[model samples]
Target: MHLPKNAHVALVDGENFVVMRNGGAPLEPKLDRSEKPDLSASNYSAGVKHQDDAGQALGRTDLEELAHGAAAAAWLNAKAVAGEIDDILVIADPKTLGEMRRHYHTELEKRLVGEIAKTLTGEPTKRIEQIIADA
Candidate 1:
């Protein structure tokens, strides 16, 4: 991927969110971790906990996972609205990516540079750099 200089890269998963900036040449990008937005303050709530018909407890973990995606989308939308983001690439687990897509703001969508649907939250920074370079 030919990320522009200083382009933002967001790596996210159900439980992790990271932001990095390309600080080197676009082709040989060097990623530096940037301070991420505090998503904990967002009013992202897990969906209904119980089945409406069966009255059985639905999977709490699943609902929490959905909230994670909502939080990410909300943060990104805020950045876009504030003109804080120039260009951005999103790297996320497939499920989270799908969830985020459903909530993407038009402004955010306009600034999107690319997206890779794979979980890389646990990968080392060097590995991530390599992956982005290869993309």
Candidate 2:
């Protein structure tokens, strides 16, 4: 898809965040991935000991954090559904970004909700301004 006529911003953060903007800059500046699950031994054992079935209580905090990160990227696009913007291209990391391109055959058949055009990844923060030059 063609880039929107309106200037767009693709934002990325140090905590591994991805967001896109068109028609207007993103209002959310700081990435908020601070909400993480506490995976202390005491915390995990407490629920298992009492309920014996906390389901997923055995999971580690790192796993939960990564899942939240992916969800956060999806949420940004959901917020933009009403706008006239073409679409956004959000990339979490080099690996996922590469994966998206490599599995294009499979992804193309199923993925269409978010950005439509192929996009450059790796920290949208630095490249946000360069989009115009690149385009």
Candidate 3:
């Protein structure tokens, strides 16, 4: 698919995310993973009890990772709201995409134009652009 000129593409996964602007110049990273540390399950679980109101043990690993992904989505949302981006194309794994959908603000939801349900966080910019263009 041909992306709109200057469309913002957000490549995200549970651990990291990067926002790229598609333009005459090569895809340049607007926001990168440098802001957040690479966190492990142990880091998020330390001192945090994984239980429900009934004290039943609950799985928090995925949930914690989802929250991190949502946080990355929120950052993109803020940028969109600020008019820093015109449109959005989200490329992420199914789970991260679901989390992004769940946590998106109303304004950001309206700005979304495309989605690719695959993990491409570590893919090179040219490769990602080719994949999207061919999609």
lDDT of each: 0.83, 0.35, 0.68
TM-score of each: 0.85, 0.34, 0.71
- Candidate 1: segments with Cα more than 4 A from true spot: 41-61
For residues 1-135, write the lDDT of model 3, one tens digit per residue.
656667778878877777776663333322323223343333332223433444325443465666666677778777778887678888998877877786677788888878999999888766787778767
Model 1: ten consecutive residues of lowest lDDT:
47-56
Give the per-residue lDDT of model 1 (tens digit) for 2-70.
988999999988888999999988888899999766676343453443224443245334656667888
Evaluate model 1: give its TM-score: 0.85
Give every collision pair in model 3: none
Q: Which residue segments of model 3 deviate by more than 4 Å?
A: 24-61
Across residues 31-135, which tens digit of lDDT does each residue of candidate 2 receive? Answer: 222222222222122222234334347642233333333344334334345342234444334433332333233323232323323344453444544443343
Per-prediction backbone clash count: 1, 0, 0
How far is 114's C-alpha from truth in model 3 (Å)?
A: 0.2
Top candidate by lDDT: 1
